[model samples]
Target: MKGIVQLNIVQFSLIYLLLLIILYIMKRSKINQTKLLIVASLRMTVQLVLAGLILTYIFKNPHPIFVIIYLIAMIAFSIRRVLSKNKGINRNFKIALSFSLAISGLFVLSYFVMAVVQVNIFNPQYTIPLAGMIIGNAMTGVTLGMKTFMESIKTQRNKIEALLNLGVTPKKILLPYVNNALETALLPTMNNMLGMGIISLPGMMTGQILSGTLPTTAIMYQIAIMIAICTSVCLTVFSSLHFGYMTLYNKRNQIML
Candidate 1:
């Protein structure tokens, strides 16, 4: 069915109504979430509108430079967000965040596009959106892993030192918490993958179908995108753990935590 303007008004109304009701319930429950609702609404509008315009340009241009600039901006923004939320972390985390994420994320993303998907021109049409998806997933995993790793070290400093004092290597001593942090970091991406077709159709696949692609084509894109997300997130979290641990521990092998 072709789109209808009046139908969109009704759909938007229902969506906003549900959202506002949830916000009100959260406020009544003393959840301190007033700002979240406001910011979320504002962000949804600004991001979608900007994305719409940019995508139009990208679809026309499809330049590699545009793709690079976009991905770089995304990586920088994601790094800032991670650092902002987890303040008081070691300074070296800046280095860890850059190298670990850049190396692993770019590795997986490049291979996925060139080796697997094999789109013509390797254009922003294909690269930018998938790059955004992969980088965004990696950002979440990196932030969660670093945050969890740092906090775990702080909270379990006693246990860690005890193990180390008993002759356990730094790697072995930190392995448990590192594993836990990686698992926690991957949970959201994993959960989305598990719920992909059952609970909700992913935005990319749904959008493709809405724009008149065949079901088979849409499904292929969705599966490929999902695997890319999984790979980037896993690589990011794993690499960040090793990098983060090195930054936290001192030359004497004592944890700074």
Candidate 2:
């Protein structure tokens, strides 16, 4: 049977109303947060409605090209999010991060859905949602990592130049900044893993149980997703750094960014 919680729209609406009440009472932040909240809610509802219709049609078609096209769209959306998050970054940095996220996300996700699961047909049902998760997480990692790295290097341009004058390699001079950026990027993923079951109910696992999957099955998928997140995060961070550093060092191997 479909779980009873799925039909409890009234109860959910009550919680939403209570949240709105709390926001109204708080009265902090100079911006019109209440209006923002209302607009966000409306947009969310419309987006979900459209997504449901599109996904239904996609599943019926069952074509590999279209599934991949949807994945590309998701990745593009994610890149835009990254660009917005790190405002004022160089244009080349944006392009580098985009390529890094695309490559790293696709590599990890393909391994998960193809080699690990070995599912036939590979319909949109399994591919799209999981790919979205991987892409979203990887985008965060790449963007944060690249943005932080750029800021750190730019701020420490003097140190980098001194190292260059001292005949140190570009990568060697940037080592500390790169390491810190990677750590910063991975911190949220680590936090999520640490607090997975206790502090927050993850969306995918909660949905699975709500749809009648056993508790154990939900936990398994959650575990797999966490692993995939880590994998994707690491790959994206390294790739962005790997290629991004190239633009900074010139033909004479001097630090230039």
Error of 2 at 210 (Å): 0.6
| Every candidate's lDDT | 0.80, 0.82
Off by over 4 Å in 1: 1-39, 120-122
Clashing pairs in 1: none
Worst 10-residue lDDT window for candidate 2 reads 1-10
Question: What is candidate 1's lDDT per residue for 1-257, written digit by digit as tens?
Answer: 44323446567667777777888798789999789888989899889879879889877877777787877887788778877877787778667777777777778778877888776435777777777888888988888887787788788878987888898778788888889999998898888888988899899988887877887998998998888888888888887777777676676877665
Evaluated at residue 88, the lDDT of candidate 2 is 62
lDDT of 1 at 203: 95
TM-score of 2: 0.88
Positional deviation of residue 7's Cα in model 1 after best superposition, in angstroms: 9.5
Task: Report model 1's TM-score to 2 decimal places.
Answer: 0.83
In terms of lDDT, model 1 sits at 0.80
Candidate number of the best lDDT: 2
